[model samples]
Target: MKSNRYIMILFFIVTLLNSSCSDTFVDDIDLKFCGKCAHTGRWTVDSLDFNPCFSTQAECLDWAKKNGYSDRGCVLCN
Candidate 1:
């Protein structure tokens, strides 16, 4: 009986660890640009606008350049 209890506990622990390690958010990794922002002053996963709209930092910077926001890049909104 003790062995069975131990096995159950082990199974529960394994299941918990697996769930914790799994990615629960978006599958595709999204990046955000924070040019000249106080947050990071660069590209990052976290955004002040809470908008992770670009797939790559280059794309985000491109948008910024095209939209006349090269100096203070705009956050790509979703």
Candidate 2:
């Protein structure tokens, strides 16, 4: 009986640990919420090779200037 109780306790602890280690969120919020105001990888803004970077006009401009890029316009909604 004592051994059975210890086994049950171990099982409970293992279950709890497994559940806590999961990367999945417990809430129902949309994944988009993580990047709501952030850049969405749309619009290239320069002569430089671009990747998904800024989420705002200002950010794009700053990036262009820092990298010596000469173009500053929206590419496509990424």
Pairs that collide, model 1: none
Give all TM-scores, in the order shown: 0.29, 0.33
Per-candidate local distance difference test: 0.57, 0.56
List model 2 lDDT by residue over 1-78, tens digit each.
999999999999999999887555546433332132234554445333434455676776676667666454534344
Model 1 misplaced stretches (Cα beyond 4 Å): 23-78
lDDT of 1 by residue, 1-78 (tens): 999999999999999988877574545556554434435444423334433356557876776567555675544333
Estimate the lDDT of model 1.
0.57
Q: What is the lDDT of candidate 2?
A: 0.56
Candidate 2 lDDT trough over 10 residues, lowest sum: 29-38
Report backbone clashes per prediction: 0, 3
Evaluate residue 11 in candidate 2 and report its C-alpha lDDT on the 0 to 100 scale: 100
RMSD of 1: 9.7
